[model samples]
Target: MKNAPTATNSQSTKNNQLEQSQYNTESLTDLSTAAQRARVLHYLQNHRALTTLEARHLLNVMHPAARVMELRDHGYKIITNWRQDSDSAGRLHRVAEYVLMAGGDA
Candidate 1:
């Protein structure tokens, strides 16, 4: 009976690992806050809009709202709009979609 519990725990641990691996958090942590800000700004400048999911997956930014806040503090004009997006598990989540209205002094 104890062996069955151990097997279940092992499988649970593996599932947790798999979920963490899907996000690639290691690469996100490798980027400095300034670098992450720069990437977010550049992407916004070209694309004009960025979603939280896009920032995480494409720009490797873990906390995009933090980066956007930093940019706003630097005088950048950014606006946040909420939208419903589906996650990998197909659950709907209200995510922030940021739009850059103007550039600030660097």
Candidate 2:
């Protein structure tokens, strides 16, 4: 499932194409937080718009609070959007969903 290059001039974009072409997504959803972060961006060069918990669980990251900040310092727009875990139950919210900022794109 490769898309024609999006007209970018960065190796990161190429790397994303390479990774997406070579990964077994069946096992991807189960990676550690840091690993997940690395993997997500690795496969897409998208490094922002991540959720706090998603960043934590998927990447196996211990200090996302700091890491996200650092990444922001470098130029990333992180967003926090929540989804309900269970519908019409009592009231519990699933962690927020994340997407990479366009800037990180190559």
Candidate 3:
């Protein structure tokens, strides 16, 4: 005999799937604030610019603006450009694109 799936179980499964699809677990598994800031800075150095979506999906930083602000406070020159982008869930949003103008203190 086998037990059938309940509504709660099905809903939980859907939520899990949604969460998995929304975030890159491999990149986000373990990262501290400093690590995320470093990653974002390195990425900006190589890429010259980074969008909010890129920060979230590629760098695994949930709050890119906060990281950017920290970098700015550290004397890094960063500029923000607004643009519309679609998230993992295909929802349109006005996201900030941060462009690195100059490097600051180490």
Candidate 4:
């Protein structure tokens, strides 16, 4: 038999995640474009990887690529990898996944 998680375990997990998110929000001042750009970089720095859809869903930004361009302009070497994937409906599309390089001189 497979081990299953109980309801109490799930609630505690959600509470912990909520507390972590609250702490993360304290540093965000406003929802300006520059702030959004910083958030994108911060996420890339912390998570080390991000996709266009993830940025759109999480940061509420329409153009994550533009934010990536701004980061690059500021001397952040972000690498973009194009991936072909199929959506839930079976429609295929190309997506850009970004990663911040360790040494961002280029």
Q: Over 4 Å off in model 3, which ranges?
A: 1-28, 102-106
If scored against the real structure, what TM-score would every candidate get?
0.66, 0.39, 0.67, 0.63
What does candidate 2 score on TM? 0.39
For model 1, what is the alpha-carbon lDDT of residue 16?
47
**Tens-place lDDT digits, model 4, residues 1-106:** 0133456565455334433443465344546556667678768878888888778767666789987886675567899999976655777779899998887522
Q: Rank the candidates by TM-score, best first.
A: 3, 1, 4, 2
The Cα error of candidate 3 at residue 51, in Å, is: 1.0
TM-score of 4: 0.63
Q: Which run of 10 residues does model 1 get worst, by summed lDDT?
A: 1-10
Q: Which candidate gets the maximum TM-score versus the true structure?
A: 3
Q: Cα RMSD to native, each candidate?
A: 15.7, 9.2, 15.4, 16.0
Candidate 1: deviation at residue 12, Å? 52
Clash count for each candidate, listed in order shown: 0, 9, 0, 0
Model 1 off-target regions past 4 Å?
1-30, 102-106
Instruction: Find the number of clashing residue pairs for candidate 2.
Output: 9
Candidate 1 lDDT tens digits, 15-69? 3433344345334465866667777877887899999988988898989999898
lDDT tens digits, residues 1-106, model 3?
A: 0132456565455334323433443345557665677777778878889999999999889999998886675556889999999998999999999998854322
Q: Model 1 reaches what TM-score against the true structure?
A: 0.66
**Can you write out model 2's per-residue Cα lDDT over 33-85, one digit (the tens) per residue?**
33443444453344445555555545545455554443343344554466654
